[model samples]
Target: MSSPRISVILPCYNEESYIANAIESVLNQSFTDFELIIVNDGSADNTLSIINGFEDSRIRVIDQENLGPGASRNNAMRIARGEYMMFLDGDDWYREDALEIAYREITQKDCDLTFYQMINYDDETGDIYENDWFNLTTLDELDGKVFGPEETPGSIFDLSVGVCQKIYKSSFLRKINAEFPEGIFFEDMPFFYYVYLKAKRISIIKEHLYFRRKHDASITHVVDGKFLDTVPAGQVLMRIFIENEWYEMYKFDLLAYKINGPRFALRYIEEKYKIALYELIKKDYTEIKSSQYYSDFLENLGPVKKKFFLDIIASRNYQDFIKLNS
Candidate 1:
């Protein structure tokens, strides 16, 4: 068979309840020239069974021991045969025309990546929230808005880092060796960060092309030791910036992201792990502060944010910082 126009990588773990719908959504897409690579990361539930129920020739299932989403995606990419690639969680469904529109736009412009909008779907209440963060509206407004690191340095940082809601050229990813770090939570941030830096041209499409299901089982809703992976993920991002010598150019954004790690731990981590996580945060913060870019990042912050950062740095106490921010 000839290579498909797009490869949709859907990684699943214990998603029996939603995996069927997810697979059905892709199979029913208006665009048919795509391969749906479903990676079952050792799901204990009926996820595999549901995936097997799909008899479509385009659907390819890979069953393996649980290695987490990062590893599953990496494995899928190794075998993917498509001109472009897109990611979709096993619990989320795409709009019927999502692949059709994204494929058309990205191919027409010959861009490295194409980012579209997505709706946040609340499964409990069946409420759909439109994306307002980017304020994207009309096709004409988003058309031909191609940006690169040199043309608009900050624009890459502004775009959402979610691997979903975006389609990437297979060649671009392969050329840069963009692979997710296995066993790490929040791997999307670092992976997307690397892609943004390497991509020569990126285009934006204003249409909402995906439905991101919000549920308790999702990573953002679960609280556990794995949340600590955010620290290492941030570290990987910083290391990438330093290694690429892009630290000086994106220091402020990187610093903010690093600081947000501890802030997030303080707010959401379970009490049992808070103390240990705090120490990890402190060590990372200290190392970041000693970097040459730290002072520059601080100096550029506005007065209010600067004071807040100083207070947190000086306090060195998670509770105290929380109280001050609260």
Candidate 2:
């Protein structure tokens, strides 16, 4: 078969209930030159069966064991025969013109990657809500111009740490050897930073081009031991910054993230699982206290936030962590 102009990869694991919509969205896209690569990550449910239901000449299916989405994307990316690529989650669908719009901008403006907008779909309520997850004003300020990683300070951390919302040049990704961090729940954070740091130029569009499903059972909502992966996931992010010689420029952000990120994760976890999470956070936070950036973080945190951050770490147990915050 001839190479496709664009390759769209959909990765899913037991997403039987939502896979069909995602498949249809790609099949029904206004741009027809793209190939759809569906990675069935060992779904135990009817997800594979659902994927096979579609009849499209452009569709390619890869059946693999239950590797995480990171591995799924990495595996698919290596084999994709397209000039450009984008990712789609099994539970989410794209706007009909998403590929067309993103392709037009990426090609016309000659950017390494271009990310459009996204709206949240609350599966429970069927509500489609606007999410200004990125600083919208920042994009507006760019005024349709392409900007490099250095052009925007700390931009590697500013945008939504999700890849499904962006379209990347296949060659640029290959050139930089961008691979998602595998075997982790929050791998997207590290991979996102790694790419932005290597990206030569990128564009942003205000047009909403994707629907991100939000539901009770989805990965984002269903908290478990996997949530603890955020710590190591963050460690990966820090290593990327340091490896790229960006630590001094963004260390304050990293220190603040160390302080606030885990707290946010623990808040939603069941009280039963809070202790393990606390132990991990306590160890992580305690170990990093000696770093000058840690001291810089506390020094600049001001009185109120400092006390709040300290109180979280100083807790004797998860209960005290809860009670102190409460």
Candidate 3:
């Protein structure tokens, strides 16, 4: 059998309430020649049953023990038979024309990847809002423009790290071995940087075609041990950068990313995890501090940003850090 032009990969975990809408959205896309790959990540609820209720042949369901989202996505990608790939969260749905527009633009542009605009839908209060966080619309000059990561250097970090907000050329992803890191939270951080850095061509869709659902139970609202996964996640990202020889070229952007992402994330996580998170951050920074690029990074940081890293390294414990911040 010939492969479809696009494959939609949806990884679900107990998304019984919203999976139906998610499935229906893809099955009803304006672009008809596509397959939907749903990974049931050991959903303990009626999610599997709900998924089974759908009688579409284009829908392929993979049942697996609850591996993290990273693992689920990897599994789906391995078996996905598509020229292009799109990721969808189980709780989110795409506009009917999303696939049609994205596929057309990507093909015409010959882009390895194309990201699009996403609006947030709050199920609790019925609030719908657009976030200008994705560089797609904010960088007006880049609208429908074909660009590459190496052309922008470290600015690759500036793009949205949300994997679901984009469509990927399956061949490019496969060629680059862009697989998600299992057993880590914020896996998308490293994964996004991984793919973007290796991408030869990237484009954007200015139209809002994806809906990101937000609710209390969402991972963003949770503060737990997994929050500390940001440290290891950052660690993995640092390794990718340094090993790829990007760390030296973009040390400033890389350090700033660490400070903004994992370091800053410490402020919101549970208090109990602070010491551990601190130690992890300190450990990573300590290694960087001794590296040859550390001085160069500090030079690029000016005064204020340099102090933040220094403060993290100099502090005896979280209390000292708090007192310094206070």
Cα lDDT, model 2, residue 191: 83
Candidate numbers, best lDDT first, in rank order = 3, 2, 1
lDDT of each residue in 1-326, candidate 2, tens digit only? 68898999999999999999999999999999999999999999999999999999999999999989889999999889999999999999999999999999999999898878888889989998885673344556775889887777754445688888799999999998999989888877888888887888899988889999999877878887788887778778877888888878877666666556666777777767778878887777776676655777577665655765677578887778767766
Q: How far is candidate 3 from the true structure (C-alpha RMSD, Å)?
A: 1.9
Judging by TM-score against the true structure, name the best candidate.
3
Alpha-carbon lDDT of model 3: 0.86
Record all residue pairs in model 2 with backbone atoms less than 3 Å apart, i.e. clashing. none
- Candidate 2, residue 10: Cα displacement in angstroms equals 0.6
Model 3: residues >4 Å from true position, as ranges?
290-293
Indicate the TM-score of model 3: 0.93
Candidate 1 lDDT score at position 104: 94
Highest lDDT among the candidates is held by which one? 3
Ranking by TM-score: 3, 2, 1
Distance (Å) between predicted and true CA of 251, model 2? 1.5
Which regions of candidate 1 fall more than 4 Å away from where they truly are? 134-142, 222-224, 289-326
Candidate 1 residue lDDT tens string, 258-304? 66665666568888888677667667667757877668657776665
Choose 1 or 3, whichever is better by lDDT.
Answer: 3
